[model samples]
Target: MDNASAITVFTLSGLNGTEKYRIPLFVVTFLCYSLIWVANVIIIVTIIMDKNLHEPMYILLCNLCISGLFGTAGFYPKFLSDLLSSTHVISFPGCLLQGFVVHAYIGVDFSILLIMSLDRYVAICRPLVYHSVMTRQRVGLLVLYAWLLPATLVMVGSITTFILKLCDSHIPRLYCINYFVNKLACTASVANFIIPACTYTIYVCHFVIIFWSYFYLIRTCRQSKEKMSKFMQTCLPHLFCLKILGVSLLFDLMYIRFGSVDLPQGLQNFIAIEFLVVPPILNPVIYGMKLTQVRNRIAQLFGKRDPMPHKAEFLMVEFESSCPNPPQDPFEGTQHRHEGVSLNQDIIQAFSAAACLASGSRHGLIRLGGASSGSHTLFRHGEAVFKLKQQVSELLLF
Candidate 1:
């Protein structure tokens, strides 16, 4: 213990073999880190700023992005420096700090996922009670749990490493981790192994809670298409994120515990780093794009507008093909009405299934013959309203 206490720095050998392509790797790593910050900040700011997005579900989503940022911030900055420098090393105190940040980030993430799955279960299966049960105050508590539980649990493990007299100062991996740091202890106490074992076990129970919630959700939604649709629309992103985090973390844990030394350095590096690399960037994207409200809000934030309201009942999505070459008056002789909707309005809307306003933008007026006054919108660029109102006899749109 006396000899081990003398060591104050650790050497990371993970980047030792990357001398040939280190520059390119540094460039890519820097971009990935930059992207992680931008993506997460966009989600965080968008949710905070949008009033309609103040629901419990979106609130939980904001935390997911926050965890992604927290976890990656622990690893990326130091790693980018390691990529450019000759020595991949960290001080003993710095190593423990990294481990705590990484572990606590993952711990918070697991708790958040568990809460998200249960939120879906309630919203889908017991919707009558969802609001009463998951109020803003309750959601605040859940967010608190998401942050504190893992932090407390991971802190115990980090502290044990801090007190241990580290016998080895060389870490064979990319960055600091509790599991790896514990291996540095001169004499392994049962607390060294038991604290982490208990932490991992407790967090693994989060998975049990998640599965318990989703199992009922899937079964309940099986009989109702509407419920199923809601499940797909809302819960799919949560489940997809779970899969991503689960796979990446699981592979990383497995690699660290049982990975073969014979494996190539590149594959080993990827396995070790994927948890930090993939989730931060992907979490924001899936949540932002997969969930309708976030996607629409993002579009609005960028000055784009949706011309049509999202309700499909009000929208007639039918389209038709335009003729390659046509007589000036294809529908000149006939006037038709489908259920009191004039041929004029029908052609204007359910025109060729081929050409319609993209994103239902009011921009890009389509000119058919001459121009008409109001209620005419361009499908794209600012043409005129399609003159189909001039001749709406028999428009053929399948």
Candidate 2:
């Protein structure tokens, strides 16, 4: 209590007694941080630049990567610098800010993953209404909720922690946490305990809601093989991401309460920073490798394309146009009419093209294609087809 007024900086004793390994640790940390930035930046930029990827699902993923970047930025820079220096100290405000960013990042991860699962549910269980329900405005709003809710909770919690009058200036971990900071309080209050409990309870409810939604998602997928493939393609990555987050955060929480000095220092350090290191790197990689559209786009960027068969290509073999005066030739555009239904000329242009980006209908991707391209013109809306060939090498559809 007597030292409460004199402290301006806190010592991070996590780096204690590891002086000899500092350079090696710094190198590894730097590379890890660089990989985090590269992986995340690739995802963010790829989603933003590719118009084919502008769907609700991809948009949500972009935000996920953004949040990954947000959270890791708070830890890695400081940790890297600390690894190289004999004295690992942080100013009062810096400690709080780091805590705020890291915690908010965790909050955002929980909210976004839940939002993503709901998105998967709607897409798998209610394909027809997916677009209508996940409208641009609604998606924007959902994303807003994902970000604002956690940020608000974390800010309030940070404020609560900030008001504490601490008697000690040493944090044993590599970073600051409101929980530990509160432990240094000259005195304790009911609000401190109440607020943290409430915050954690809310996040727990988020997990509950997500699991329930996935319960239904799994059930609906079992009804058909197509549905099952969709579930495996899209939902698996989300589950993996959720698992990464759960395990890392859970270990850290357990360590906070039950950590024993008998544990190896390396093990303790890993537990404390697992969330900071693992999730940021794996989230982007998992989504990239799992999702069809994202994976194809990334491959395309690197001048490689994966072969995928498309269902839409078979339907495009022949289309009847009710143009007032339709061209008899499929290759050359003309006006014709049949059954009083008119097909737009754009269909001919779209069907005639061969190399398409393959993110065709907002409704869904093309899933079936082994039938060769035939001499028929169809009014495909969003696909580009220059099909004068007897066979399509392969149609890539997201």
Best by lDDT: 2
Q: Give the alpha carbon lDDT tens digit for every residue of 249-285 in model 2.
A: 9999999998897888878899999999999999999
**Which consecutive 10 residues in model 2 have the weakest lDDT in total?**
389-398
* Runs with alpha carbons beyond 4 Å of true place in candidate 1: 311-398
Q: Write the per-residue lDDT of candidate 1 for residues 216-285, one digit (tens) a residue.
A: 9899989878568878888898888899999999999888889899999899999998888888888899
Each candidate's TM vs. the true structure?
0.78, 0.81
Report, for every candidate in turn, its global Cα lDDT versus the true structure: 0.74, 0.75
Candidate 2, position 173, lDDT: 89
- True-vs-predicted CA distance for residue 198, candidate 1, Å: 1.5
Q: Model 1 misses residue 131 by how many Å?
A: 0.8
